[model samples]
Target: MACLKLDARALNGLWNADHWERELSDPRRICVGIAEGSDNLSAVACGWIVLDELQITVVAVDPEHRRQGLGRTVLKQLLLDASSAGARQAFLDVAEDNHGALALYGALGFHTIGRRSGYYRNGKDALIQSLELQTDIKLN
Candidate 1:
């Protein structure tokens, strides 16, 4: 719902309503979202659980809602959900130039593991990062 509104504003049209519906229907997927109001979302984060690992698929914050901790809140909840689902670690690829995201991930204890050249449609390099999850980790 919120992601559908963000398709053009934040996701660059990489996903649609149907895509969200399908992913939401999957039992192995974890999604966390923060709503701005009854009909709008401020931030969202989602990941897929595979065995003991979590592959983070999406993390988006509406432009108007950036830099207000919404991204951090949703992501923390998503990671907690993944950990509760038996994920021992988490992984994600972020564009190299996305300083905000890199800072957020770093603060959350994610370390760079690899890089992919020209990984995005805009020719940006992707930095792969990973974080070890602890079932008892304090998120507050």
Candidate 2:
């Protein structure tokens, strides 16, 4: 729901967003999302962003909430926020088999900027995409 706007089930155990909470507490990496609701405190669309480059590192929505456009909403807001704060480029990596994710990123004005071969644990390829920073990058 954040980086790639993907669902938790689809993501399987490929990632652990909570484990990153401590890492994101740092100023360099950003994490943002809506609370999961009363008592959970866990968030929907937990995203990891590289503030300096506006790169999206991770994002996932709980399986129960899939297809609600929450993923898109979160991703869009993050990009907008990055732009507002000043970022000329947003980058990300995705498993090549994730066609849906590729499509969403394309719709968001992100384009393939590079590739890292043999990069996945399963030996699948990884596509590196980038969203051009339309505005000058500035992080104050």
> Which prediction has the highest lDDT against the true structure?
1
| Per-model CA lDDT versus the true structure | 0.87, 0.62
What is candidate 2's lDDT per residue for 87-123, written digit by digit as tens?
Answer: 6578889888888778777777777877899998888
Q: Backbone clashes per model, in order?
A: 0, 3
Tens digits of per-residue lDDT for model 1, 1-140:
66788656777778888898977789889888888677687788999999999999999998888999988999999998988888999999999999999999988888899999999999999999999998333466
> Each model's TM-score, in the order given?
0.92, 0.73
> Predicted candidate 2: what Cα RMSD to the true structure?
5.4
lDDT for model 1 comes to 0.87
Model 1 segments more than 4 A misplaced: 135-140
